[model samples]
Target: MARPKDDDPDMFRIIVATDIHLGYMEKDPARGNDSLVSFEEILEIASKNNADFVLLGGDLFHENKPSRRTLHGCMALLRKYCMGDKPIQYEFLSDQSVNFDHCQFPTLNYDDPNLNISMPVLSIHGNHDDPTGQGNLCSLDILHTAGLVNYFGKTSNLEKIQLSPLLFQKGTTKVCLYGLGSVRDERLHRMFVHKNVTMLRPKENQEDWFNMFVVHQNRSKHSATNYIPEQFLDDFLDLIIWGHEHECRIDPEWNGIQNFYVSQPGSSVATSLSEGETVKKHIGLLQIKGKDFMMKKIPLETVRPFYMEDIVLGETSLNPDDHNVLKKVEAFCTEKVETLLDKAAMEHTGNRKQPTKALIRLRIDYTGFEPFSIHRFGQKFVDRVANPKDLVLFHRRKAGVKKEESGADNELLAKIRPQSLDSARVEDMVRDYFGQVEETSKLQLLTEKGMGDAVKEYVDKEEREAISELVKYQLQKTQDHLKVRNASEDRIDKEVTHYREERKKRKEEDEEVAEALKRAHSMRSQSEDHPCDDDRMSLDSDEESRTTRGRGRGRGSRSRGAKETTRGRGSRGGRGSRGGRGQMKEPVIATNGNRSILDAFASSSSSASQRSARGGNKRKTYSGMDMSDDDDVVTIDDEDPFDISSSSRKQKSQRKTTSRRGVAFDSDSDDDIIPLPKRRR
Candidate 1:
């Protein structure tokens, strides 16, 4: 590719890369410094080229909490190559407060007088290094705090995203760089579909500035909503830097529909031995002059070479029943390994500084043949390969499988392989597991998205009570809804009872289904005679009913509730201690003041009450007392009842109170009060 000329005074030269994955395999003796070396090379390139700044897509570090060695190495590299006395040419035009809201300095590193930064490294957090814990801090935040990197695109709110661009100007050219760090793919997809994400455009020169967006999301369709569609972005964007995918496709591709150019500067270091990671790694030099930009791919010479191949012993002239079968199979595998080593050596010919040991993966199909010990076979390449233990894997092709089903299986595996390395989040795993179930079989009270979010919170934040809190919040909301409809006391009790029974039944059924699935999977693995293919074939069969249950429980619960209500109506006269079967009760909803879980629901309910007041709804009597519509209603009483003074009771009696369903009550009267039903226990 031809490089753009550097003669234009208004041109902006920026170095762009992503998924450096620093500290990957940091403990491994052979590959400990691999990520650090490549990262240093990238910084050296930026310094040599005199780039305006270094733009990182995401995942600068492989681990969310990087080790001390990784942090020290990263700081040393940035200080060595990025700090200098060189004058900065480009000028920041955006509001620093909005762009760097998460940072204390709230300005460019160079702009801070305490820090002498020459090369500004601007980045967003990827799934691997996203925020966690109570402080909502990521590894990048530490770097940002140290004034070594400028971290933008840290989304504080997921309900509605308002993307504010970091605008910069060089001479007469202007560039508006919008960024959205990384959000859970499914949640982000839903936001896009609901039109909740808003891009804040430049207010002044709307057409003059070149609009560029940096996003770290799944560019490919992993599932229905696992990836963001290109069409979701606004058409006004000139170019987009896509990240989070590991494949190296640094060249720009035009999206004809959106009329924008997309350049995916994939990961600079290989974090896995998958085929996608085998692509030659490269970073890009992005040059922008006004609305036109060019990408120059610079190959990294320090990345370790990886080679993979698959062989079938059944296809070759090898007999399983022969006395020398094991020897022949070993010989064939040895030849393949030697050939791959030679290929890696040829590829690494010019780069003498690169690691000598290459990553090799040989998948052997041993159908109709006995498999040899992989541990013993790998011992031969312990000295020649970086990953000897996983160099060779054995598998068997199941017989009588349809082509369509086989293709589907392969596609599913393909989607999982790249992410399974390091980018797979807890939410992604939960989403994938639930993806196999039929939509109708999913939980009716709680959404699949909500459950996935809860599980993600529990895993990522180590919050032991997150799942329980979600269950309680959902149940509370359901009960509140029942109260809003002004159901009779007996009806509310019946509905609540039915809900509890259904939830318990579903829980039991799900446990049984999960156990059965586990047993079936185990049996299939034992019968397959190939343990190496377990992970790949785990979700192959029973794809639809994998995590699903029959709807019989819901139907049965409804029928039983109907019968109980009918029987209660017949025995109404026998139970005189209880109120009449159809008697209405004042809605007394309990509120936990200490918990913030229901704060959102409280706010929504308050707004609904305001709307109801605006609609001029009439106030109804609760205990034969007429109250004005302007009376203050407290449906959820959080005050201390025992500590109330006589003066406070007088004040309460003066002000008329109403229920959520518009039933007004007198605080001083108790003649018409009906006692609530006591627990059976």
Candidate 2:
């Protein structure tokens, strides 16, 4: 690389900054104005330096979709300085025309003096402002359309990433500015290895141009995790602007290249309270000549002062109730706050005279006290100090505290003996020591001095066994109740069956009545249709035979309506005289328990036939029903046959009780209640 000739144009001075994080303060209302304030301060500094243009590395906004208030404030601030004043003009150095494939266009005419954009802001979207959805639009697109900023480093096609350079001639310096937006680590690695992906560079003899590469990538010297190695960019780029790191850094003549420089402006405001965030932040100003560049570190005044203090309590088993220890911690916190206030007062000047509100992070190293309870000491300090907006208190066990060797630990360590100590042997010893220490700690927790004693001291072995037996007894009782309930359900099923049988019997009786009526109707129809004397004679003969049989059975008083025919005959030889015989009787139907009416009738008919064969005039009984020669003498016992309650009681009494464990309690004795041991308060 050669220096620019003295006859060439003036030097190019561009203000370079990154990670404004515009919407970062939306969460904490008290500190919600911090990010925007810091950003405004940066813009003011850029304006005061007479910068040609502003280059934002990445993450101008903290969120993909900033809040309405945040966007408004940002637009107003940018437009106030960059709009309607001295529109910048750049002479084209390369043959390539300006490409707006995935970018936006200005709303107003660029050449119009009324629509001049003076100090134009150029930036690329970081991870936070990257397209979140399929739409492929971001918050930066809005500002671009409004003619407030120029957003490069985007591709119209998402499947491929291509770096597009903004080629311009500022004075005699041919500048080729190429930008690559933030990509996820995995995807970034893929892009780097891709055959089609390549950086935008000057063609052929145009290599004399200043080739500056802007990227938002994690670059670290020691760890390769998610970082792009600097060696990879050695040949392609002259100057590299790095972002996404919070600490400010400048490496002039990077990689031992005399003219190559890698500069990082870092975050203008702290987004998180990490160790790196407490460092002094700065914005960078790059003055580029032909192959060489000069970077100046400008400290940011708008960043809130942050102080992190770590106090070692020195001893383990700290008591939270110790007034002396509490006083010591309180004094330490007070001294740290006073020191910060004094520093702020010395630095305070001009229009920034408001009392500095500091973020004091206190880390305490103490053991045996719960982390939550240690906040009491921090709270005392907070109450004593004024203008303390936020106080973060953290407690941890001292990192290298020496542990007292117990007898058990000593015995365990004594068993391990080796000739000499190598790395492997030392590692083994360390592992064994830690293991023994952990086991000892666990064993201590089990003794009477530990919390387990609170429960073990009161309940002895006998009481525990008694409790176990009681649980088993109650479980057995529950099972018995379930069995009794099942039995009751079975009984209900039986009753339902009995009722269903009765319903069937009533239905059969109805059918019989219907059949009798239907037969009578047919008989009347036949008599009316057949007037022939021969048909009538035949029907009369049948009727006469049926009547004679009924009379022989001594059923003279029975209605001529023709009762249901009985299957069995009586034992009497002939019809008795009217004076001696009782009124004619019609056999009544009787049902046995659970037996169908037809089955009962069949049984009764068979029994009567056997009695008639003996030829004796005797009364018969069937299923609690009395049948005699007298038709008026009918006896039926109405009492139910099944005693349901008595059976239930018998089943319950027969259920075996579970055998008692431990002491037996006789409920039948005078004392039914067993006394229990009083609980210790």
User: Candidate 1's residue-wise lDDT over 638-672, tens digit each?
Assistant: 23436658447534433321111122233323344
All models: lDDT?
0.72, 0.56
lDDT of 1 at 145: 87
| Candidate 1 regions with alpha-carbon error over 4 angstroms | 1-3, 349-352, 398-453, 478-681
Model 1, residue 480: displacement in angstroms? 4.7
TM-score per candidate: 0.67, 0.53
Q: What is the lDDT of residue 289 in candidate 1?
A: 86
- Cα RMSD of all models vs. native, in order, equals 20.2, 32.3
Count of residue pairs whose backbone atoms collide, per candidate: 0, 0
TM-score, structure 1 vs. true:
0.67
Q: Indicate the worst ten consecutive residues by lDDT in candidate 2.
A: 444-453
